[model samples]
Target: MSDQDSSSSSSSQTEEELDGEMDEETNGEVEKEESHRDSPAQSLSTFSSSLRAVIRIKQKYQVMKQRRQEMALALSGAGTFPGAPTRTSPKIFTFDGVTPSAFPMLSSSNPQKKKRRRRKRVLFPNRGTCRSPPKQERSRAKYCLYLLFAIVFVQVYNAIENLDDHVLRYDLEGLEKTLRREVFGQQGAVEGLLVHLKDYLSTYVHNKPLVVSLHGPSGVGKSHLGRLLAGHFRSVVGETLVLQYYVLHHCPQEADALQCAGDLSAIISEMVERAEEEEKIPLFIFDEAEHMQDEILDALWTLVASKQSNEYLNAIYLFLSNMGHAHITKHMLHNSSSTSMASGRHSALVKELTPVLRSSLEKLHQLWSEANILPLGLLEKGHVMECFLDEMTREGFYPDHSNIERLAGEIEYYPAVGGHEYSQTGCKQVVAKVNLL
Candidate 1:
């Protein structure tokens, strides 16, 4: 009985020990499972912190790179490529209510779309082929610019021309009126002189001096016309540029011709030099040119010839001569008709008389060949009466028309065509007759 009781007790004790060991194993397994779950929470916290730190570092790196690129662009005049990296503030990431493992899934949600946008921003050109301006439009703009430049150039050119014309003013109209009013009865001579003067004075350049020869009988106003021209030129260009020389007064027949030529040449040289310096045209009138010796004419020819110096070429020379008076008087008495006295007939008269007058003067000097022969025609009886009236009025006396007619009728007249008579002495005695009045 003792042995049976002992055996039963041992079994119970052994079973109790085995049960305690099993409970210990179950508690250890439960503690391990709880520890494993708790470890996941701690690992998640650590992973989230590390992930935020990594993101912050990457954002810092991106910001630094953007700043570097911006600095480079600024240093290079800000003309960098459009897709070049630019500066931007870093975006702060919040992991609230989100697991660290879900970060990759969230970032990858629209990977294709992100990649397309990045490529478009980084590689695409700012201006596309379709957006570029057309070649035709560009050419039109260039053409418009050229046209505007051309218009400005043309306006400048015209302004310069107008200014030049104003500066070189020659009052031809005033000269014409003065000649027509003051110089009477020699209509052809006045017209020819004016035409030549107008053409020569219109421009500032000349190849040679203009030489005009006035040929007629004595007492036919040759000296009077020379005085008028000298006065006109003096008024226009001042006194220094006008030289009125008389053969008898300046170089007498008894004086040495060589010395007289030298004096005349010096005077002409001084006048021309002064005129050129002042940009002016000069006038020279030689009265009684027929009395000038060969030496004097030769000196004049040197000055007035085509081969003269540039400064000497810009002058007007008037030669008053009685060399062709005989021929001129004969031709006028033969052709003195009312028809021949008209302005239209003046050209025919010039054509007929130029050869004869030029031939007569050329016998004296070859210089006359180079001259423009202007013949002073014989005055009519009516012109003589008009002259008497003019002289009477000029000497401060009241002109009596009947007395003028009587004085003009007393002057000898040659027979003319159409019963019109011309005075033989063309107002030469009118001044003496007026002084007697």
Candidate 2:
């Protein structure tokens, strides 16, 4: 029985040893599992950090690309094309928004860098912002307004340059009243004279000069009417018509009629020659032609005949004389029946005159045939008033009808010879005097 008890005790001790070994193995396995789980957490944290760095690098690269494109566009003189890349880099910032930290790697340690940076800041203060206005549109609007003002100033200067000082201005009403009495009242008498003058001018007279003699008493305004006709002719034609003034006063010193004819012929030839070369037709006005030497009349007759071929020399000789027509015609008949007889009497009388004078009178009859004669009569009361008013107005003075009546009364009844003494101011003064009376 003691041997059986010893075997049982040994088996119990073996069972206790096996239980301790199993517990040690279990504890080691639990510790290894805890270590494996902790290692995974650390590795995950490292991976996350690396991924964030990569993303930041990519974002920085994109911003740099945009900045480069914007700089190229601003500095280049070339205009941008369609579909060009327009993106600009965003400006990088430090912790404080006031300071920029972009491209800090490019900064230098040299003192010159600070100066360059300062200049850059001055040139482009908002360089970081880089937002711009459209440039081309603003410049075009400024140019258009400048052009408009220049055109208006030129037109005003041209208008002031064309005003004339010599032009005479008159009311149309006053002129019509004068025409009614002088031109219309004479019935066909004035019309007949104008018709005859027109016919003589148009007709080709062979060596025969047209002598239109206007004979009337003094203060009749005959010379004034002649000037008016000459003015009308000039207006119709583009150029002025030349009218030569000749005054024939009775020369008490002249020996005979022929000598006077020679002198007159030389004067007519010189005037006619000048008119032909200048392409002008002249009117010879012989004022007081009746008082001329008989020789002078014959010399004029010769000149009219010699100028037949010269178209420009085909002239109108207006003889304003106080001599009656009957006396003139009777004198012509007594000379001779011969065609040269009219000029011969003057030639015979002036044979002893200068050689130049003798040669001039040789063709006196021909010149006489080319002349036309027209008689001027006294102006009617209305016509006289109209002329006086016209003269006053043209001198920058205005006159009423009462002024005209007074001027007409002062001059019309007075025995003043010719209208030369009828001064425009004198007419006005006379009206003022009458007003006082």
Candidate 3:
């Protein structure tokens, strides 16, 4: 009975020892799981710190990039001309929000020369490696960049255009010297036109825009004079500002006539606005003004009456037509004095006869109907026979009469005494007729 008791006690003791070992094994397993769980948290913390560092770097990079762009704009403006790039003083970077502990500070122990060389190599004073911006920050930064680029481009273009304008301003010294040499026997008329034109273009003449109506028989230098004026003005003002539209060519079909008129209105509006901005005079020439549709004329009447935008104040309008030619000739025929007829100086006669022609143009309501005229008059007379003959010869037309007498005789002016037809057609058929003659 005592040995049975001892065996039972020994078994109980062994059972307790086994349970303690099992408990230790379970505790070890729990500790291992806790350590594994803690590792994820530590790794997350590390990742967060790395993200903050990258954000800081990006911020610094953005600041540096903006500063560099500003510097580049300034440098480009200064170096707009070729052959030399502008040199500006180097700018130093400011470390405002950055912490020295976060990023190691780089120190330069090199000489001034070495430092200058390094500075030249660097795009920015504070260049550093950094990751791309975050998505939200990236979008904001792109918008700012685009805005900055647009503003810079506009400013640069304005500056360049201002410089270009200064270069483009020309001197019309010799051009102003010999103005009326193109046409013959119309020196008086041409001189009169030029005087008024120059006066109208005069800077002090701020009264209103000039409106010149050129009237004559067909083949007169009316259209040719218009071309000459275009060339002269193109030399003075740019070719862009001198707009010549022919009613016969542009306003052909009756269907789209109104549309063409509206298009012209829009164009005139834009050109007037442009002229006002540039402080320059714009010229609009309507060749064959008598032939345009009434609707188109109404569109132009706005410019004529100065009834459109205030910007129209800086523009000039020229109307070339044969509307008042018959009235001019009748007045001349009735009033040609015996002294004038005997002197036979055509220039003097045309010059003296201008007053009656002006009166006749006033009666013709078709021209400058309600508009205020500024030194306005009709520029008339065909090319002089002498000038016509020279031009014909220059054009490789050798008439049978080498003396230029036959060509001169053929160039007949309007209101020829009884039954002669000479230059009444102006410069129109002289060449073709030269072959026929």
Report the number of the highest-lDDT candidate.
1
Please give me the total number of clashing residue pairs in predicted model 2: 36
List the candidates' TM-scores in order.
0.63, 0.37, 0.51
Task: Please list the C-alpha lDDT of all candidates, in the order they appear.
Answer: 0.77, 0.47, 0.61
Candidate 1 wrong stretches, greater than 4 Å = 1-170, 337-344
The regions of model 2 sitting more than 4 angstroms off are 1-190, 200-207, 230-243, 248-263, 274-280, 305-313, 325-373, 411-437
lDDT of 3: 0.61
lDDT of 3 by residue, 1-437 (tens): 34434444544454466556555654655565556556756676565655665565566556655655565455445443566544433435677535645554333333556778787678444335445554643467888999999999999999767645543453333344544456644555565666665555544225556777666666666777778778877877787788899987887887888999999998888887777777777888888877878778777776676544556766788888876677655645554444654454545656655555666556645546543222212222323455556566667766344545555555545464433323555556555755664
State, as a TM-score between 0 and 1, how close model 3 is to the true structure: 0.51
Instruction: Sort every candidate by lDDT, greatest first.
Output: 1, 3, 2
Write the candidate numbers in order of decreasing TM-score. Answer: 1, 3, 2
Query: For residue 422, what is the lDDT in candidate 1?
Result: 72
Question: Looking at model 1, which ten-residue stretch has the lowest summed lDDT?
Answer: 72-81
Poorest lDDT segment (10 consecutive residues) of candidate 2 = 163-172
Report clashes for each candidate as comma-separated counts: 0, 36, 7
> At residue 165, what lDDT does model 1 achieve?
70
- Residue 227 CA displacement from its true place in model 3, Å: 0.4
Alpha-carbon RMSD of each model: 21.5, 29.5, 27.9
| Best-matching candidate per TM-score | 1
Stretch of 10 with least lDDT, candidate 3: 373-382
